[model samples]
Target chain A: MVKASMSGAVSSMLNCRASSLVLVLVLAALGGCGGASVSVPGLFPVPLVDRIPLPMGLHLDESLTGYVHAEELEEQGEWEIDLGSAQTQMFQNLLSGMFDSVYPVANPAEPGGEVAGVLVPNISEVQFSTPLQTRSDYFEVWVRYRFQLYGRDGELLGEWPLTAYGKADEDNYGMQSREPALQAAAVAACRDAMAFFTVQFRTIPEVRQWLLTEAGGPSR
Target chain B: MIRWHQQALATGCLLNLMLAGGCVTSTVQQVRESATGMNETESVVVLSRKTRPSQEETEADFVNCISKSMRGGKQRVNVVGEQAFRDALFPWFEPRTAPVNASDLPELISQPELAERLASLGLRYLIWIEGDTDRTDSSGSLTCSVTATGAGCFGFLTWEMDSGYEAQVWDVRSGNLAGRVSSEAVGTSYMPAVVVPLPFIAPVRSSACSSLAQQLKSFVLNEG
Candidate 1:
């Protein structure tokens, strides 16, 4: 009776081990075939500020005409990044703070009549690097732009090249999520770009001249 | 048990084959318009609307490939060289400064000089190809350490390349968007050792060029 009981227990243990092994294999197969995706959120409205009351027209260049969503795959799963309309909204918000009247090029009717000059913002490049791709601890985002000031006569007045970077670090030991980090990086990069533009726009000689001349005096 | 093992082996082989043979994915979007066929008498000009400083060489190669492919197609359309097209239109207009937007066609073609120049060239359509091919993602354990004799890397490294391109067609005579074609190709390349390098798992730029050219030919000839 004792021998029989021991034999039965050994057989049951072997069966359990075999079943667990099969289950793991099946799960591994499923994981290899499964697909995953990630997305970046759309642009939320930036804080509205009191208009500066200067006449300025804002035009997005041909390159900045549309939004793009980028995607990638990893050993773990699939990932997606939504570029959102944050680009357009960011510029609009920044320009609104500096100018009294802001006109979007999309609207043909609103060309900012009697405006001093037009500010054309061209998105030169947008690069997003995932942690898996860069082999880095953080997700990275970089945005490069060229801000050009054009006179009413269609002559180029001034141009400034601006670049911004954003990064989000991984949490403790693979516990972190990528989407939030990516979003934070992108937002930070945009904010940095805008801040750079704000400072450079005021200091650039050509821009200073244009603003001062348009305002009819240097004091304003 | 044998049958199950065989099934798993077959699945693994299939997966390996799929990974080894990278896929080419393309998308073509065109506005609803009357299919205007090309004839021997009329010609089409394929040009890069905006060639960045870094992409000049690639742009030139792309333009040449497209023109060559269009000429080789069954349509027998006269694909003009970029130089000839530039010579005909330069000084009067600059594509880099003012890209011809499909939406702003009417205003652009309304210019008398522009219309006359295009008409003189006997140009039926203008195809604008733009965008770039770049390395997007990379992974695996690849570490390089410098030794006294030389530098070497250990372990395996793999990276993904993405090629995204858009070709916009404009009906020169009507100043309307004839069509737009976009192609995207993605593939992963691997390097097992530091000494030996696997160039490209997928030929993205070539794939994009060939695919775009073929589609343009079909679009113009109304073959597809």
Candidate 2:
């Protein structure tokens, strides 16, 4: 198919040159002179995007995951792998593996409200032009999550905007594989949101009052 | 230690041979709000309900039926205190996903329709003003004031309030925020009752349309 398209381009280019030369060369050919060299055509190529870069400071949410390959990543509410609903596991796993990062979290019971902190990320809303006819598949996700900690009295302290980019692999498109990717996407979304809260959690008066005055909070 | 042929014939109860992980479960409950709007019309409508808060002028039976806690036939009940919905034999109910197209569909739900219903019940302009209590609640009396500022309350993008909504009034004929009247949306669920998550508390109203109208009228007509 590729060869056929290439040849089609070459022939069209030749047809154009032939018509132009016919007027100039007819009388020259009548005098038995040789003709000019053949030229190659510049074909239109499709745009291709190979990979999307991961954002910074977004910790993937693997709280429901069943397994984690790397022990260093073994933390409460953190998992390397998780079981996804049936019909798309492999694809999930591929996406999840891509999101190897951490999320900054503040204690919700602190004197002030918690803040969103640093987290590694895996997804983004800003998209590039789609690539045509490769084995890879793509889906777009637009996320809007707030970052910052507020108090009982509604005082605002710190805030940040979280964003991410996400993709799943072509080979393992099953539910299990895809579960990783889905989680990676969610984690990437939360990273920026978490970062914002990290700063906001400290000084928000409402948060402080809620933490200090409220019972079973700082202890819990 | 070898007891020989004395191996007892034992039977095992096949318990699901896996340990269940720790969990956090949440339960949702449905409740109604005492709706107050800045529109002179909203107050009169709320006052007409049978279960309406007599002392504080609050509406009742406006349950949050859409909450996750609702089960089976419970989801079918609208509970808006209408006579048809109230009748034991004819309990009316509604479900939703998106805002109803009030302009095209006569069945579409909107605040104007609610206002019309209130108007039918003889209350023309029951407006409820919204604002924070500048002074702390003291001596069992609630003292506060609401403010609505803009061009005749023409546009409603968002209240710009931290948690709840505030309405700004607009002239429907001229299409501008009149800045003349307005109301405040009071969300008291997240209030500190016993600390903790306070999961039992629900939003003040299930009808966002009715509340949105209140916001507009409150901000435009009532806010100082």
Candidate 3:
């Protein structure tokens, strides 16, 4: 009886050891899986809108054109999101569609005589949340953009801050991969920004004033 | 010889085993607020309500399911793709900018550009869907362990899922609330394991979608 009990105890100890080893390996694997580099798409569908009859100059600085958000998120490790090229491309498409004429200005401080006003846009903030963090079934992203409008003589006409939010259901992806879900969220945010900007542009008081002055002059 | 109670017990066990598979129950109701009708040229678009930040919006797949159902079947109602219609209207139909109520439609379409786009799409009805499916309750436990010879799971696990969705149909041409349809479904799923776990997943959301689509099709077609 003593011999049999000894053999059983040895087997149980061996099983416990094996389980511990497996748990350690899983933890190591999860720790090693922490970095993701994402690039959002630039292509967007043209919006349907009556073009404003004003000539606009798009001034994209190096920082806005090559913007990158890099952060270390505790257990999530490192994340690098490149939104510069995509934002630049989307703005080009959106502005061209909105204005009767859109041209690139070398500098916002000295917009040429050909354009009525110059629009300088920059990313104000980028934030994201994963299912692990929110304890929800969705991955979400939020982007804020600040647009500074400069008049013909390089005087600041107005500055508008636009915010956009997007989310992707984790159940839709059906996998453990986080990159695709985050990318989708980011793309959705960009689309939201485009939609909001297009609809609410004329509603902004300063922009409306600029439009009225450009179209009907100070008296009218 | 088998006793009467023993035979009854065996039969009961067999019946329970048969009932352990996927089973779901659904109820659908409709409220007609105004007259409704549809023509050959006129079509419908299914959109999820995303204006409210606090409320959970309807799932995209559920909207597509309703759209697809409307497009198919014997009645064969014309259905416009959501994304395409949204893109055609652009900013006007966006989440934040979309008209909140039927009363706001006139102001929205007052824009010549938006009016023209709406006319071109031949959109007669806009179905705005809201709600989601969630696991309401869960119990039991499942544990899996691996040995040198093999791996297996042991235990019985079960969960309850509930789906509730409401679709509001608007007659865009008239800018009137034609009707509203609601679908509610409840189901319990089971996973019983001795060695390998056997999953019997109840299609709660699918049931809700199917019932809602059926009711919506009938409601739209019946021109009273």
Candidate 4:
């Protein structure tokens, strides 16, 4: 009787273990089938950094034009990117840092107030890649923009093209959601692009000439 | 084993059907006035209202697409090139000074010289297209990583696009508004990938252009 009872207990233990294993396998399979998404994250306002003040009041044009390419996603998908509004915020921050007074202009042709120069920013291209495509376990985003600077008189000063790229990857064994990673990548790319513009804008000869001339230097 | 295979096949067929059917959705609205003054013999000129210097190329493209689509319509009508129309009215009228809303048509064409020049060109109807298409909402997550060999993206990403356009038709002879056509197209796109990326959504611009063009044709030709 003792031998038979012991054998019955062992059999019960084996069945219980098999049942638990099957449950875990089913849950894991379901988890693998779950879907993920990516988007631009909210940005905190950038504090004004100390920089050489531009002589004339600067105007940031609100109208932005560009194309977003995610054909598999939708036609004219770029319009959904909202890069214009993103750039507007970043450029406002940058211009406020460089100029004592910065104005947001709805119509560059008919600005409400007088401004020394108008800066038109446009996102030319955006390329987004998911971790599934890269297989590197990272999310990547790249953005390109064209900046056209016009003098107060509506004369085109010059145009500059800027580019930025961002990537997100996991450093540990545990993986986070891909959406957060993509959002982080997009935010980083925008910040990097704005930073590049703030630093390199002064280097453009036309920009320098326009600033100097507006400050009452030798008229060309 | 046979039952499991059947379940898998059923799931695959359902997914294929869903993908093929629910990719894009579009809607068009049009309003035509009852005044009978559109002459098929006279040419219709498509014009883009000048807003900013940067919009020049975009306006040109819009004009070209609308004119081409109108020409391809079953009820054929004379479509004039933008350059010829501009050349005919250069010194007297500018796109900036053109009437935006239908209400301003009477005051605009009241001037003798402007009316004469427009009449000489045999311009019967002017189609003014304005507004832009933009992306509205985006959600989902995508993770892409680069390796020495290549890059891969895993996860699903989806976004919504909206194309909003307003096309106003002006009858030049009567100096009256003939009709107004507005088209709004909204579509959601999805990118899903477990191991490989799958992109399945139609473009919004083409959909907007075609739908608007078709509506414009119906309005001009008075077709149901």
Instruction: Please give, for residues B130-196, the per-residue lDDT of candidate 1 as tens digits.
Output: 7766667765554333335644444454566677777778887677788888777776655443332
lDDT (tens digit, per residue) of candidate 1 on A96-126: 7557767765432344456667887767777
* Superposed model 2: Cα runs more than 4 Å off: A1-144, A174-220, B1-224
Stretches of candidate 1 off by over 4 Å are: A1-220, B1-22, B27-29, B51-60, B92-99, B103-113, B141-153
Question: Which structure among the candidates has the greatest lDDT?
Answer: 3
Residues B124-159 of candidate 3 have per-residue lDDT tens digits of 888989899877877776555555676555666667
Classify candidate 4 by CAPRI docking class: incorrect
CA RMSD per model (angstroms): 18.2, 33.8, 7.4, 19.1
Candidate 4 lDDT by residue in tens digits, A1-220: 0011111111111112322422332343344343344445435234223344443334444445223333343321221244554555566666675666777665555543468777777777788766556555555678888888877767678988988766554221123444566666676577667556655766788887876777643221
lDDT per residue as tens, model 3, A1-220: 0011111111111112323533432343454457678889897766777888888999998888898888888877898778887977788888887888889999888997999999998889999887778877677888999999998899999998999987877665533447777887788788889988887778878887888788763221
Question: How large an RMSD does model 4 have?
Answer: 19.1
Compare the candidates by TM-score and give the number of the best one: 3
For DockQ, the strongest prediction is 3
RMSD of 1: 18.2
CA lDDT, every prediction? 0.60, 0.24, 0.78, 0.60
Model 3: CA > 4 A from native: A1-35, A217-220, B1-15, B18-20
Interface RMSD, all candidates in order, equals 24.0, 38.8, 12.8, 25.3
